[model samples]
Target: MNVSKLKKGVLLAAGLGTRLVPYSKEMPKEMLPIFEGLKGRVFLKPIIQKIYEQLYDAGVREFCFIVGRGKRAIEDHFTPDWAFVEYLERNGKEEYSSLLREFYSKVESSYIAWVNQPVPRGTAHAVYMAKTFVGDDFFFAAAADNVFIGENVPQKLAELHEKRSTPILAVKRVNDPRKYGIIIGREIEDRIYEVEGIVEKPKTPISNLANTSLYVFPPEIFKAIEETKPSVRGEIEITDSIQILLSREIKFLAYESQADWVDTGTWETFFRAIALSLKHSGGHNIVFDVLEALREK
Candidate 1:
């Protein structure tokens, strides 16, 4: 199968996010602020937007956003605001207006369709909801909570998928394997795992390579998901389905990313992501400048 033919990407953002409650009580977890500036202004962008931008850069022109009932904000953010954009232009903000217009133009070009995940099902169920949209081909999948940052991680993943013509799962080496889905396998090369098995949250993990919620799946995955039964937790596990596929001699390649994996599902990881983003945004220096100004006061 030619992976170049696979052009669709699915973003899973329908989780209830019970872990980040109080904060997530009003806003979707995907909308959480991962960065802020010292100017008292927040430089926050939805997780989905960042993932979408990466996919767009990877030649993925179509997207299916799997959202739940309270995820209207996700849809609204992607929707074009032509009227407001024109208003900005009329008020002598042509630069800002043009930027927004260009953004809307890209949104229009990108075929973005929203699929509802009414129930708080597992990742497999959320992905299965987009099967009809995927048709008979391979597609990309990324969790909204995990942001992959690099020069061209998405494009590189797409290139690998096209070369191998198989499902490619993104992974990162972590010191603590028990906290994530650990991928156990022989290292064929540096940072490349053959993926003999994937153990989700294992007490005694065999490897430190944790699955980072990025995947390139073929259409057969939909069948595997259909055959999958709900686990003891009453949620259909995507890993179980992928294991079934692996048992059938299907190839699951593990591609390691050099970029940092920021998991924003918890308070600690969320703050870490904010700090990293701030450092990248030149806001760290701004913080010191603000501190100096306050001391001079």
Candidate 2:
């Protein structure tokens, strides 16, 4: 089974990100700076870009970005800037020019289309907006706020999806499963869990494996979403749709990520994610040196 043959993807980035408050007031939380350079050119790639790059690496060529009304910034970032490229070339910054050109080329090739979700809807609603684009096939879905950091989790999941011929949900075992959508399953192997049931934010969780907001879904999921009812909060929950699919005897599998999963919705988590990213960037030693220099100054 060649998973690379399936070539479509979806990214959910329509949330208001109210938890980040003042910082999110001006910019999308997904666009928050995770790291900065001494030259003032911040390495502030959004969560969307990280997910996009991962999917791109996993052989997903067409991307459907489900965006809200105020997410023009995201669209703009991926848009080609011919004028900027020309300016860089005129100034003899050939390296910078080439880099931007390469980035835009990837965007042009992979960005199939964009779907607008006009209202501040829930995850299910955002996903439903991509139904037209998804058509009738299995596609990859990832939340913009959650980043999967393994060397090849995306590639591994893609391969697993093709081999198993089923929907795959990335799950991780946490001490407090009540804070997430928990999955009850038979442990097939060290990190592989054969899911029997899924409960969203259960009061008394049956299992410690919680949904990590990354999934490869079959087209039938759209139908499940349609049949799903809104929760007490008047929001269409994706978890409800998953439950419906499970009731229909759909085969759902859970795979644990080898790398860390970070949720940057809150300030604490956001800072932690930033620190983790910095450490991964191989600049932690430099950071310590800078701190020492500051102390001496």
Candidate 3:
């Protein structure tokens, strides 16, 4: 794999999503529904597809999905059923069939591979599982439980990484740094920050720049993960591993994404993500519907 190119990627979707509750019990939070419009009709696409589409659009040709035991739905959804297409055509629902065809084309254009995490480790461990797949490629890794709304997020990140020639993390200024991994750094360029320190959920807001869990890492990251010690939660954290890299004076750049990321860690944000995703899907009334539903409650 070319160091300058990002042709491979990984999606960490193995989390139990305890906060997403009863609904996530049977399904992965990454499988949560979002309103998408294709060929002039609104479609309910899982959050994973939303993530995949963005990466695919950014020129990723291969993907490795880190999933747990109950994520069979994800596999089934990606598998194209030619018989079903014939059935839809026989029933005169050719438009929906075309939608399926369009979806099949995307799957054909890219390679999809899955690795069972089997257990819920930390996010770093989840990413580590894809090391063999990543091999020597500098690849993009994203937390699949998020919906990112932006005009050209991945493209922009790729451009930044190409210019910097090192690991680049997507970061943003947030009011609550306590709930996130804060990047302690000084702005080297306009929106790029040279990472000096990273503390996971600090007591005080030293820096409002929070790690969005979107990274472009080189193959050397596996070595960093191998040297990292587990946290108090008994899980290997990517932040800690990156911190080790920083402590060694290795350069890590943070790119402030001009995107609104909606994580499924909470119900409110999930709904907001569905609404906000409409702007990318051409147009929709899901945002208004979400507002009305919340108003009634």
Candidate 4:
């Protein structure tokens, strides 16, 4: 068995976020805060930061972030602030500072590159922007707005890739397949499928396995993206690109993840993500208490 290890990651954060409205008007959706806890204290961290840290924990040392207009905040947040850490330490807040310190150490030890996507061409285009950075390496291509709260899905995907040595797509069973890209595949094993076809937001659903925007892609993905034409929405969809690869006999595997897949794209999902994160952080009781107190007010 040929074992492969992944050390490169590409994060796509270049969406217009028209659905998020005012919250995303000035802030990138990827920069939206998610609840986190350490040492019995709750902390708010950006979703993209969480994604990066999770991937880092999975042994990915090189990162390429694709950003669009007004997405400079994502880049800025990734830049460590020593003065803030020092100020926290000065105020006897070692816990908060320690978090920053650890995060900064990870950033300092890793290679992070930013690529500008001037136009909102689509997901495939955003991924294509990292072609030069990734360069023939099997890397994790993830959407910054989405994350798996309780499990390190990237590490699991890497492990599966190591065993199979094929392109992998993270999928989840959804009740409403019309809102997501659906996958049609032959089940090879438990929670594993040989992906035969994938379609974006199909009118007539074929499968409930929705694409989760987490992928372990090979270098051929870039070529597939190049050959992919625009979708009905006039944007290059990553599903279409994968379908192109499928046509050429590029085998892909669909891994149906059981982890809590949180997508902070729309208002409903964003609120749900916050709730899930709070629950994961063991802070839901505190939130419930506050809500009850507010109810008395």
Candidate 5:
């Protein structure tokens, strides 16, 4: 089984962010900004942008963004605004303009498509919508609202897939596994597991390995998702799709990473993501400065 290096990428950003109310009411939650700074300039970028950049850095070029209604903001944001970059340059904000310019360069060089979901569905359905976009190639898929903050899980996952030639799930060890889709597997090697089963938000405690919603899946996953039926919640869960493949004796592997997974879906986690990003930029003091400025305002 020869699995070539993944080139196509799919980003699921179509979910309605009910957990985040007013802030996400108008804007997609994936558009929420997180701290990013370089060379004495502290700034913020949408988490989706960060995710895209990470995937781009990992060698993914052809891209598809699964979007739903009220997600025009995502498309607009991904569009390169050379005029804005030029305006910043004219204003002597070269550092800031350079960042945008770099992002724009990536955007221009890639093949990006926006596929509308119209009605919000679960992750399985969102991924199924990209079947044509992915074609026969193995591709990387991720939830756009998340940013894995440490080591490059995407790069590692791809490398793992090259050797194992199986579907790969980026897993992480957490204290509480009840909230996430937990994996039951046997360790084949250090930080790698041969996945036996997956339990979504299990009541009875399972393993600490939690699915991180980042995957390197073969095109067969689309077929698995197609065979998957809707769950009790009337949503086509990706966990169910994985179970389908498992029952068919298809091997899946989980990569437990050291990356700090930051989920910016709710108010609490959103702010926590900001703090974590600030820390990553070595600008932890900027958080206090922003707070003081807000206090004065």
Candidate 6:
């Protein structure tokens, strides 16, 4: 039983977010609030926090967030503020702040780190920045834009990687290949696929399996990235790097995300992510609440 032991995670959060515009001009989109609520008092958990929490719960404690300029808010949000906690206690607002205190403690307990990229590069380049942190160990890589639901999908990827001893990718079956990275692979069994190649937004449709940008990779990928050439988009593509692995006869596999893979990169997708989260939590106000929330904003 060779279970993959992926202990570290690399989150690519350095995108310039031109699509997000005016709001993203100052703050990194990762730091934007998914929803503000009272954790006793008002608590604002940013989109990246939800992303990190999901991976943290999946048994990844040591993390490197690949960030760029204007991302200090993300770093500050992760920093433990003991003095603020003490202020609440001194003012006898301890009960009101307990949940936040615990939340901060959970985050502080983990070894979360930040690495800055000089510029906004493609996802692969952002991940390449983590080479010094990841070394040669197998690590999980996920883009911050993906807001996944339910129990540990990283665990699912890890388990499959363990059995197959191959790199694992999380994917979902979608109708449009033009909209996502299409995976061309042969099914070994059921939903499990032995990926032969992957193309980024293909003109001609390949399999409708969309790569969710959630992956468990062998350290060798850093070398592949180094060898990769910049694409027509003028950024190094992870798919190009993965092609190197396939070219070398390395076995790469894809795992179907049992839960939905929600894209939270743009305003529209972010809104949908919030709605889905509320709906999945069985809150009856999902429809009106999400709509009104969007309207009011």
lDDT of each: 0.82, 0.80, 0.85, 0.92, 0.89, 0.81
Task: Please provide, for model 5 over 53-164, each residue's C-alpha lDDT reduced to its tens digit, 9 standing for 90 to 100.
Answer: 8888888889999999888999999999999999999999988899999999999999999999999778999999999999998899999997888567888887888777
Q: Candidate 4 residues 1-297, lDDT tens each?
A: 223489999999999888998878778999989999887878999999999998898889999999988998988888999999999999999998999999999999999999999888999999999999999888999999998898888888888988889999999998999999999999999999999999999999999999999999989999999999998799999999999999999999989888889778998998999999999998989878998999999
Tell me the lDDT of model 1 at 258: 87
User: Ten-residue segment with the worst summed lDDT in candidate 3?
Assistant: 1-10
Model 1, stretches more than 4 Å misplaced?
1-3, 35-43, 92-95, 290-297
Runs with alpha carbons beyond 4 Å of true place in candidate 5:
1-4, 288-297
Q: Model 4: residues >4 Å from true position, as ranges? A: 1-4
lDDT of 2 at 206: 88
TM-scores, all models, native as reference: 0.90, 0.90, 0.90, 0.97, 0.94, 0.88
Candidate 1 residues 1-297, lDDT tens each? 224655899999999888999878767889876553334444656677778877887888899999987788888888999999989988998766765676677789999899988897798999999999999979998898888653456777898887778898989989999998888777777766777988777889788898888899989999999999998789998888889899998988898988877889988888778777777655667667888999999
Instruction: Kindly list the per-residue Cα lDDT of model 6 for residues 197-281, writing each as its tens digit.
Output: 9999999997899999899889999999999999998989999999999999988999877786687778998787666665555
lDDT of 4 at 233: 96
Give me the overall lDDT of model 1: 0.82
What would you estimate as the lDDT of candidate 4? Answer: 0.92
Best by lDDT: 4
lDDT value, candidate 5, whole model = 0.89
What is every candidate's alpha-carbon RMSD to the true fold? Answer: 3.3, 3.0, 3.0, 1.8, 2.5, 3.5
> lDDT order of candidates, best first?
4, 5, 3, 1, 6, 2
What TM-score should be assigned to candidate 6? 0.88
Per-residue lDDT value at 36 in model 1: 30
Single out the weakest 10-residue window by summed lDDT for candidate 5: 1-10
Question: For model 3, what is the alpha-carbon lDDT of residue 98?
Answer: 86
